[model samples]
Target chain A: MKQQSKARAHTNIALIKYWGKRDNKLFLPMNSSLSLTLDAFYSETSVELSDSFEADSFILNDQPQNSQETAKISHFLDLFRQTAGIKTAAKVVSQNFVPTAAGLASSASAFAALGAAMNHATGLNLDLAELSTYVRRGSGSATRSVYGGFVEWQMGTTSADSLAVEIDDASWDIGMITVAVNTNKKTLSSRDGMKLTVETSAFYPAWLESAAKDLVSIKEAIHKQDFQQLGEITESNGMKMHGTMLGATPPFSYWEALTVEVLTKIREIRRQGWQCYFTMDAGPNVKILCRYSDAEAIQKLLTTAFPDNPVIISKVGSGVKLI
Target chain B: MKQQSKARAHTNIALIKYWGKRDNKLFLPMNSSLSLTLDAFYSETSVELSDSFEADSFILNDQPQNSQETAKISHFLDLFRQTAGIKTAAKVVSQNFVPTAAGLASSASAFAALGAAMNHATGLNLDLAELSTYVRRGSGSATRSVYGGFVEWQMGTTSADSLAVEIDDASWDIGMITVAVNTNKKTLSSRDGMKLTVETSAFYPAWLESAAKDLVSIKEAIHKQDFQQLGEITESNGMKMHGTMLGATPPFSYWEALTVEVLTKIREIRRQGWQCYFTMDAGPNVKILCRYSDAEAIQKLLTTAFPDNPVIISKVGSGVKLI
Candidate 1:
């Protein structure tokens, strides 16, 4: 009756990372990437449109947002309005369980939820693929969050072709453990970082060149349910991403002492015969991939090593859906 | 009457790093590399060749070496004996002002000194070039340390052709600052790490393919005395080297928390318009390269940032020499 809709979308971790953008205007990736949505972190958003509203209003995490923060959402909403051919203003409320811009892929869930809520509220009736194309306009990773479990973001030539595809529901025994380290905003933003690496890093060319090969090999690994091969490739992909950062002109990194200690300990754990692997985004936190049977043990080991930090274990999650 | 010959060799930091081994037996590098010898870290060795000795004995840092370490020296001594046509047990006494096995390039100085001392003590009459070839048999980087300032190691087809040559004395205003983060022995030896990276890293091929190009470019920069080009390539080479480790099967790193902080601060310093850059070895420490004019200011900043760690400043140094 209130012309309102609510939706939730889970976040994801890239097993094969997307580092450089070929087209910043459309957020077109230079390489295809693979990711796994997690059950532990998600975003919920509700949108209401009516003739009674004076102007568009936005709220996040139970707080009113300033124009600067709301500007991005407002711009994204304009696209939905243009499609629906409606002048009515809307009120948007979003809440996130994931840390904002902390490299936990929060925007992936946030915009995925936003896209779903808009679809319901405006009665756009866009399917998942069409919806993914729109969702990616907000955040590149959000496209993958439109689908459940394993997904792949194809580095297509156009926006329509560049949508994500569901790879597997991950019915397998795979799991992930996250080490949430220093929550402080990154000193370097991903936008600036990607640009810096593309423009200045000597290895950026190599990163771009090898990404396709990596995607193909990793997809095969995922298909064969080869946990060792998958884990090894995923770990190497993350390191390659960080390596590009180090080769950036001014050179930057998101790793902390805790990150290195955890990495070293994880290597030791692997030597001890655990099939665990690690990946990191543009933040100091590290996400480890392992078998569900080993998740509890890995979490326990990490908890013991980093007693002061938070260790969260998560399983594969479903796609964005409306409630 | 001591019948001893003393030689001193200064350590060198690689601008174009030597990462992989093509022939492990002869310590042949997969790629040619360039380096700068520094005055701050050097090793001195006194070799006494006498028939009075029952067997070859070695002393390092004023302590008698264990059989394991002494075996390496004994093997190296066999080369000198082969060249001089004599078999004599030698008492090798060595001292280091540099941190051993901690990425400060200590082996470069240690082995270079050993080679020079053996040449003098045994009357091998090996020229500097021949001595460098002998030094490289112990450690690949030792070849570069045999020459002063700007030096290049040729990754040749065989041991006879693979040798180090001096490029320049670097009499210009260049200087290096070392932040010795930790003095502990690394858990993974360089030999093992190189082997693992070679066998496992997906990016190793790229690193090997790019080294010759980097060597040529850095040489041009060195000849022109272009600080920015030299510094940029040096920084990128280190990142590429570290990148191979990340792609290794079990994956490891030498970075710690302090390493990231220092890297970030260094970036901030660069943004403020300083002609300074950074490179790292196989440990948690960092080396900053800058003009001699800015060395003091850079050292002051680092000293203030890391009061607990030792900050050493060094200028271009001479090649290995007998006293």
Candidate 2:
């Protein structure tokens, strides 16, 4: 086995969101989802296996992780050790490149990088498609982080079938700008939110149906290189995901006052002849999808409009790979 | 025909909301809804039928109305004239007691008072239930304003069967507070908004089903005098109504930054052991549902949190009556 192995993976933003899980244990989605991999945010992880280590240890962003956090990483690493027939303990170090207080999605990149580094250290030499299944066990969206540009997480019936596939190279005029609207910790995690929505919300079934249609249409738009269609579908799909949360038994919203303000500003900018659209995840921040040439201008406008908040611009990014 | 008649009607806030409409011309809602009438906001109108007048004229809020506004009143008065078999023109004078730029639903009170005054002036003398059908034609929600306390607009198959029915007198410890967050005119009117939601939103069918179930549950809560259950149903229903709009094609939201801020404050107050909940309409304003005794205290807290916004408290109001 390799002594040490390092890998890096970039984050991806869902256009047709993967909201609910059909199989929680395997992290299988209820519907297929499409996303764009971006250059700004990423996670680089190094894994070292040795006979001298007492137990598995995890260091994240230069800080030692608690037992609970370390256990999660160790449990994930066990899958590799079981396949390779080894009982060696490993020490993992991960550094996240996401902005401070941005509240962005880093778990996708983090788990993807860890999956790549562990695979290399174990000498498994698995293909990217096979590696996605392992990455999904860490986080559902992490499956897509194994590929570059536009990737799709197919909602397969079995664990072996559910895998990420690259759709488009995203080499054209595609760009993203993120507005960090709030720094507070989220009251509800995405996993808990999606579980409540699936169990309680009456609209969850409809959301799944709409998402399936959106995935088909978005893929067509990507093939045609139609930015307008892609933007509209992405914005509408993101809003629909949040909409289901509002119908839960005890309703909740991830949106804050500044989130809505930034959305309104985006619409106003669009009315002024700019081809920009907005999408939000399970948090208060807003992401603008626009033409690559228009990203800098849009970032400047958002920085001026929200002087206290951080504005970030990112273009198309590559897939997970060894250092 | 009588020379003159005057009537007053109080506004009602929906606990279980009416969103999409089934019949656009007759203003029939897709689902039945429940609401409570409040004393703080109302409309009073006087109607005088005369042979000397050649045309119908309308004076609203002590000012002469323009042609477009006068035409709407004339069109409503034509229904009374047609029913009474009279050709005499009527002079309509209306006064609104709502706060300046509060964005409260005044159309319900306005049309209910107009219906009552016209019923008396034209000697139609229709009972309140029969008058509710006429009031619904002017505005869908106005049907519920014909009665005081808790009222339900039952969705009927035809124009004659569809009418407002009083469910409970609401004489318990029921109270409300209005938070006027924004004074700007809404970009999308409720009529257009519902139309788009019904036509474009994939979740519209689910909303209709959920609303029907909510109407049944809320009525049970009202009957049992279960304040907590009633408040929960009301808040959930209102949020679900707004949620449907977010799923529509070319999605939109009636919420503003201040609107969300006020909601956060209300949630914080609830966490501090206050039995207060919130509901919203097709605009940026928010209304609180709480125990009659807690109204004053909640109002004070909201005032301190949002000093620039107007917060008004109100108790249960009576039904439409002659002056």
Strongest candidate by DockQ: 2
Q: Count the backbone clashes (under 3 Å) in each candidate.
A: 1, 0
lDDT of 1 at A162: 86
Task: Please identify model 1 stretches exceeding 4 Å from their true place.
Answer: A1-3, A51-55, A63-71, A78-89, A99-103, A208-210, A224-226, A268-275, A291-301, B1-4, B48-55, B62-68, B84-91, B99-105, B265-276, B291-301
lDDT per residue, candidate 1, A209-318, as tens digits? Answer: 66677789888998999999999888888888887776565566778877888887887788889999989988888899999889999889888988888888888889
Worst 10 residues of 2 chain A by lDDT: A98-107
Candidate 2 docking classification: high
Candidate maximizing TM-score: 2
Clash pairs (backbone) in predicted model 1: A257-B257
Candidate 1, residues B1-323, lDDT tens digits: the string is 23589999999999899998999999989999999999888999999999899888999998999999999999999999998888888999999978642347578899999999989998877888878889999889999999998999988888887899999999999999888777687788888998998987666787787667789999999999999999988887887788777766656677777787777677668788887888888888899889878888988888898888777788889999897
lDDT of 2 by residue, B88-185 (tens): 99899999997666668689999999999999999999999889999899888889999999999998889887999999999999999999988677
